[model samples]
Every structure is written in C-alpha cells, then in structure tokens.
Target: MCVAHASGAPPSASTKAKSRPCPESPTPSSLRPMTRPAPPRSGSWTARPPCAAVLRSSATTQCKNLGPCTSGCAQGAKSSTDITYWPVALRAGVELRTRCRVREITVNADGMADGVWYYDEDGEEHHQRAEVVVLACNGVGTPRILLNSTSPEFPDSLANSSGLVGKNLMFHPVGFVQGLFEDRLDSHMGPQGCCMLSNEFYETDPERDFVRGYMMQIVRGGVWPWSTAMLGARSGTIPWGPGHHEAFARRFDHTANIGILCEDLPEEHNTVTLDPELVDSDGIPAPKITYTLSENSRAMLEHGVARAKEAMLAAGAIEVTGGGPARQAGWHLLGTARMGDDPETSVVNSWGRSHDVKNLFIVDGSIFVTSGGVNPTSTIQALALYIADTMKKNLANLFD
Candidate 1:
C-alpha cells in the first residue's frame, strides 16, 4: 500500500531523495491512488533538458529533441528508472551497465541461481556471477529469460518447476470512446492521455456478466495531427480524401476521448513462448505473446462501450466512435510469473522470490496475481520498495 504517488514513483527528485519533505508518508493499503495522466504535451515542438542535465546544468550534457517522445523521452522529463534510481545507484558506486541483453540465468550445481549470460551491445558475451538475481523484465521479458534458461538439472527451464512461468499472462485490454463535439475542447493541448478519470465502474458486479470491471479514463488529444486525420478517416471517424479535411477540422478541437482499462483474469492459454522463428541479433530466442480475450472480458468490454457512448452523448458529442472488444490492446502485461503460496502452481512466492530458486526474486508486474483496472506502475514500484526493504532485513544472509 506504500504506492501513494500520482503515478508509481515520486515526481520531484528532492521528494524521492528525502532531502526535502515528502507530501505524504507511506500508508498500508491494498488499492493504489488514482490521478490524472501526465500533463498534455500535444502540439508541442519544444524540448527541455532531462533531470540529469539539470543536475549538472553548469556542466556538459544538453537534451536534444529526438521526436515526439512517443517512443522515449530524450529530454529526460520522464521519471524513468534510469534517471531516478540508476543515477543514485551510480553515485553509491553501483556499476551500471547499459544495452546489455540477458540471455538467461545460470544456476549452480544445486539448482540455485548464481549467474547470468548476457550479450553486450557489441555482441560480446559476458558471464556475471551474483549472489542474488532479481528479474525486473516486465512480464514478457522475464518469462522469455526463464524459458530459455534450459539446463539438464532444470530441463523445463530454471525456476519453472510449476510449468507456469510463461502461462497465465494478463493484459489490461483497452478500448477507446472518441466523441466529436461542436466547440473546441482543446483535447490535444496537454500530454495526450493525462486527463481526469472516473472509477465509477471500477468494481465488479455479480449481477453483471463479468466478474470484474474497468476504469474510464479521460484521454485528451496528444496524437499526431497526421495520425488523427489519416487514421480517423481510415477508421471512418472522419471523411475520406477531399472531405477528410473538413471532417478533421470539425473533430480536431471539439473532441473528447475516454479509455477503458479493463481487469483481465489470468488465463493459462494466454502465454509467452519463445518463437522458434524469431531470434534477437545475439541469437537468443525472442518471446511470442499469444493472448485472447475471454467471454467475460468481452462482455465487460461491451458494457463499458455502452456506458462510454452514453457518457459521450450526455456530454453533447455530435458523433461517437471506437468501441466493442479491444483488438491489439495489450498495455499492462502481467501474471506471467505470478506470485503465490504454492510452488506447484506458481513461479514465485509471496515476496516474489522464485519458488524453485531461493536467490531469484521477481520485482515487476510479472508477480501481479491480479491485473487491476487502474494503472499498475504505482503498485509495482510500491511492491519493489517493499521487497527491497524486506531484502534489506535479510541482507546479512541474502544468498541463503
């Protein structure tokens, strides 16, 4: 319950570092606090320095605007782990390695994780021996590593005695409700996805067709103009060819959007497996994600869309588009290496330590037993901080 941030991590470096007073203290809770999305950076052609540059403002390193920051934030405005924890770790003398792709974790003779085989950016192989192994490779990447770490002692892959390493994959299926309005809403002004949200339908209703519900988040305009125009026309949201300009003009400023982040139950069939046909440049097998929505999820989506359309209409939308079952929407991948009490049914235990390997700990969304309708980053970071504290309590005998 320590995750009380608007997002997963604290915003300002001073607050995170504790030199300055934190607005709130950690509290015990099961649910995470919800907040509006990032500030709108739409229609922006300007760039700012990342936090690192500010740290050394009088010195070298200036931020360059690579693009829209849709792929990644070159300006370092993003509170990514590299900028946050990595810098602190380096200052503490922790050796930080960049661009190294891990192949698999190597186990010792007694089936204990002790080392890793990874390839550097130059394709040079390196074996890193460690007292503990923490798998923080999101759901998909972690499972791929485990599945590929096939050894004679643990033939089914390391720490995969449960045969559930890559199973029970859960993704928060998403569907958008776009509303075209009469007046300009300036929907694209702020960072695209960061707007007010509603949790009115966040809980499950037994009376309904699904066991769980979803969150309806306000999605303002942050998409590129061309994407909005072309895809809108292609998807029939706008007119085509000559008339498309007129349609785009009408919808551009006068649009309201909402995204539904649905809770997905863990299904063993939704899996991540190494593709025999696909491999990375280092010749390591790449993971192939195979997921499909269950009937319950589909029913939930139908209900959600209906509710969204109703809301759009109430908000005076001239036209509403985008609904039904979400396709190609796998935003929050989770439950692949789920945590549980039993070693036979789960890959990791309650604290995200591997059931088959005592030294291996998973501190990511992969340990999520359930995918909440809300954003998981805050919860994920909270869990990590909790686990780190737990490990600290046992640092004297960590390898045991």
Candidate 2:
C-alpha cells in the first residue's frame, strides 16, 4: 500500500517512487507496507494510505481538498465506484438500473437463487430473472434481503440453512478526543479526516484489558462557523447570549481531533431483524438493528482515548477532552453473514459463494469473518474482484 500526504496535492517525487499500481488480482501479499514521510504537524504521526483505488495515475484527478468529504465530494475526485468503475461497466454492456429498490431474492425450483424482486420509483413491483444472482449490498441490507427471501423449499430463508442470516452484526465502535489548540491550525482546509493515522496500538497485547486493539486517526477539526458554534454550545464550551461570539472565535479553527476506530468482535446477540410494524413505501418490511458495545470494545475505547489525549497534550494542546464508545459512531457495518469453512457455522464459503445456495454469491462486508481495526472498504472491493475472478475461472462448475 502507498501512503500519500493528506494535503491532497500531487505526491512528491519520493512518494511517487514508492507508489505502484495496485494489483488487479488479490493476493496474500497484495498490501505490502511502504515507508511514509514525516507528518506536517508537531506530534509523532504516521501517514495513512488513502483508499486502495486512489492510485496516482494520469487518468485520476487529485483531490481539491474542499473538505466535508463525508457529505459527498464536490470535486469528483473521491474515487467512489460510481465514478471509477461504472463508466467501464456501462461500456461493457451492463444495464444501469436507477431508482429501483430490491425487495428480495427469488429462488428457483432447484433451490438456487434466480434473480431479485425489486420496486421501481413508481411503486411498481417487478421481477428480474437471471441464471445466477450476486448480492453486493452491505451487511445490513444483504442479510435483510436474504431473510426476507423465504420459499417452500427453504422455508426459513434462502441460503439461511445455518440460521445465521442476520446474526453477529458487527460495527466499528469509535471514540473521539478533541484538543483545544491555542493557534489557528487551519486543520479543516484539507481532507476532513484521514490527515494522519497511528497504528501504534493496533495489535492486541495480553497485558492490555482488551483482546483486540484499536487504531487512532488524526482528523481535521470542524471549522465551519455555524458548526463550531453549535458544537461549542452543545459541549457547554460556548454559552448563548453575551459571550457566544467570543467563544466561537476562540474555537473556529483552533482545534484538533483524534478519532478511535475500535475493533468490534463478533457477538451473536448483536443483530438485524425485520421490524414487524415498520415498512417502506412499498410495504416491504424494514430492517431493525440491535447492537451494544461489548465489554472488550469499551475497554479498547477507554485505552485509545487515553493514548490520544497524551498525544494531544504532547503536541501543546491547551486542554484535552475525550470520551469513548461514541453512540453515533457505528459507521462500518459488517459480519452479519460471515464466511467460514464449516457449512453449519457460516453463511458463505471462502470464495464468497453461499453454502446452501451455490448459485448465490455475496460480495460485500457481510462476508467478513472478522472486523479489523481499520476501514473495510478497500478489503471489500478486493473481495468483490476476487469473487468475480473466481466465477470467471470456474464458469462451467460455478453452481456445482
């Protein structure tokens, strides 16, 4: 993997030498570690590599650093699949359907997935048939579709013989530590997050309270004037009325933040189920998620937050305020339909093919056996490519 600076400028000459085109086929050694340059800030930091698809190529555009990346990139340089892959797929004769919501996967008389039943924007339901069906929905949506695909042959649900369709839902439990800096850092000028990352505590140590560990990412603090005021008021740092403007000025661009991505282990109890009373506009049952941070996760968050505070203080932060197991930080959904060797213990096989329904393939986070300490997007994409290649190589025996 190549680590690029978060400044969003073209990579330096040294950085370009270390960078290479990512492999077309996934391999065990596909992500070899490469050395990174020193971070721009004062505290000790490690440059985190951007997404796997973000190779510095002539065809690719550099980031404009407009910030607010989470809200969608305005510059079209984010390299989302829609921007990077859809054009090629469209040229390859792939049909691009729009404004259609898949309701369920339909099975054939031979107990194989045939296609999907979806609803269009007009609230009209239709069935699209196929020789094989591939599901690329994320963890939640994948399991919800499978669980709702009940039939006479597979009375419980299609590819759900293991009875683990919606079980073991996992999320990246996160914590945040914001440091108040005395000087204006202009921290929000570049990519919102992904400024720098530290994996100093990523591996598990028996001495620590947690079995697994977490990653600390240096994030640019929010700098918008209105957002600053709202955050300050919510945290009681800036009160309403007389001194609000003064407090806002003090915090507008003078803060730094570190976000912790805790590795959440699989627990069968954390799950996604269909809500009995809730439904979408087409009357399809909606998915309801149930999750709680495990004791191990809470411990990891506590440790990560403490370490982040120390880093901030060492970097000359005036005040360090931190908390753990953030309620709203369940961003990466994974492990609901996990893969394994045993048919009774897993929903899919190592190749991402459903054990019970050979014609059904899953290419998403749902097939993750374990949720790692970092983001899963790159790994998910690699798995999709791997699965596609496997299907191509074994076309004759694909469903056997």
Candidate 3:
C-alpha cells in the first residue's frame, strides 16, 4: 500500500471500488428506514397516510452503457459538465462566471454585506452588491477568503467575532496493506477495488483502546511477478522467477487486501493561518497549514494497523506488509468554521449561517460540526441543500 501526502485535506476511502458478484435481491443493509416522504399538505399526519414500503435497492449492478456486463467495475458514476439537471434553477436566471475570483466582501454600516469585491484576470476590480452573501468556497478556500477580507468594521477579519476564523482543523490518516494470493484471480478484469466493506471495527468502544473508528478499503488488482519479488516475501523468503509467478498467480486468484482509513479529530493547535511572510503568485497571503496527527489520531492508526493485520490473517493471507503510520498532510481537511448551537463556541449556526453576520452564510465542509469516519462529500452536499432550502424560505427575514 502506498500512502501519498496531500496538502490541506485527506482523501476519502469511499471512492475506492469494491468488486463482488451482483446479488439478485437487494442487500438488507441497503434498506434504510427513511423519514417517510410526506405529502405537500401543511396539516398533520391525518393529511398524509403512509404509502407502501419502498425498497431502497441499488441501481442495476451492470454498467448501462456496456451491454450485459454484471460487474460494476466500469466507472462507478458519471456526471456531465454540460446540460445540468437543475432546470428550475436555470430558468430562475442564476448568473455564473467561469473564472472570477472574489478578493473581498464589502460590508455596510449596519454590519450587513453590501457587495463582493473581485479581481479578474486583467487585474481589474469589480463589485456585485447584494442583500446577502453566501460563501461556498469550501474548506481551505473559504477560510482564506474570509481572513483576507478585512474592513474597519471587521478589523480582525470578516465574520470572526469568536476569534475562531481558521482553527480546529482535522484530516484522516490513510494506510494500505497488500498481500499476494494463489490462483488466477484476473485482477484487471473486474473492478480494481472492492464493492463490499467489513465495518466490523467501525465503532470504537471503551472496551477498545482506540478513540476513533478505522474503515477498510477492500480492493483487488493486477500485480506482476517482478513487482512481488522486489516487495520481498515474509521473513526474507525469496522465490525465483517461475516460482515467484506461480506464488503470485496462486495469491491473485483469491487476493484480498484492505487499506486503513482513520478519522482525525479537531484540535485547536492544528490550524490554518495566513503566513505573513509567504505570499502566493497573486500577491495574496497563501494559506499556511500547521498541523500534525494528534495523540488520539496516532492511537487510532496503531489500533487500525493491528486490526487490519488480523483481518488479513483471517482472510488466509500468506503474507501481509505495509499497514502502519499516518502520512503527512492528508486530504480530508475539515473544521475551521464549525457550526454549533452556541455563538460563543462556534462560527456558524446549525443552519450554517454566521452568528455575528446575519447576511453572511457559509455552507461547505468548513461548517462541518464533526468529521465522521466516512467520505464528507455526500454529507457536505446534503448540508448544502438543507441550508439552501433554509435560505430560500427565510430570505426576507435574513436580508432585513
């Protein structure tokens, strides 16, 4: 397993592919009891009688574009850049620019946002005054924009009344373990990753020594015999060319491996700040992230390594190697402007609106209350939609 260091965030393990036989029936785990879709009526339960149970099944396992293929190994999903599906929004005349950079947000005397100041490629400054400003630049960019936008009314920084503009940063520690199996498993034919997950160790209890949960990245892929030889077998046991190919073929048939992905808790010390000395090519303050794995995160990694090794052994792996340590600067970057019920503790409300600035809203991973042991993209999208609904309904009150 190769652990690559990323800047500003930790990559999510959710993107990894899982290969398995397509089940004729829906998996029980896929059926979640959703809050029953209610009727449009504003009245109580009497106005909405429950309909028949909906079986939440996954879409057909075969790639629709590729004929009669049972394997979901083809690109998991695809979204076209053109012809966006949100037609209601397009008809509403939402203006979007391709490469506009907002340099700062201008505020009024009443502490309300008046307009946004941006610089285009020609170094020309432009302003777009609005009754409200919704900041959706996401984690790292969001904080950087806020810290850079300072006025006399907001001398310290825009919407930083709690002195927590760029703090409480967190990311995940990812590690991988690979094992050679015996048999002709044809790793390249199906999905290079796994379709099923073993969440046996997902929740960390007091009985366990770790403070956080570690997820497994099950994957199967092609590996040559020479690659295995260079990796070195268990206890320095080396095999010659033909012997190596035989062993690799045997292992590849039922080759099962797991990667470790552990969550990183928010720490005030792990922060993003403006490097006073370092400026980017744009002559703006570049974001300087000062962070390291916390004691809790380190403990989680150690616990994950142990658990992963055990799982490999249980799967009948003849050898397991390279499943340990947290790499530097992971990609799951979160926190900074965390939302909470209290204005004193958090920057945004549960609805993701600024407590101090009524007209300013932040909706992105920046407002994540906590980084759960899953990919944040789905959750972030859900939160954004939720906040957008809130804003649409309360626009009049918010602007006033």
- Please name the candidate that would achieve the greatest TM-score relative to the true structure: 2
What TM-score against the true fold does each predicted structure earn? 0.80, 0.86, 0.70
Task: State the number of backbone clashes in model 2.
Answer: 0
Per-residue CA lDDT of model 3 for 162-190, tens digit only, reads 87878988776776665554444444333
Q: What's model 1's overall lDDT?
A: 0.71
| Cα lDDT for residue 209, candidate 2 | 85
Ranking by lDDT: 2, 1, 3
Task: Give per-residue CA lDDT, model 1, range 210-287, as digits (tens).
Answer: 887887766664256776787676688777777877777876756667778788888999999999999989999999
* Each candidate structure's count of clashing pairs: 9, 0, 21
**All candidates' lDDT scores?**
0.71, 0.75, 0.59
Better of 1 and 2 by lDDT: 2
- Most accurate candidate by lDDT: 2
Global CA lDDT of candidate 3, please? 0.59
Better of 1 and 3 by lDDT: 1
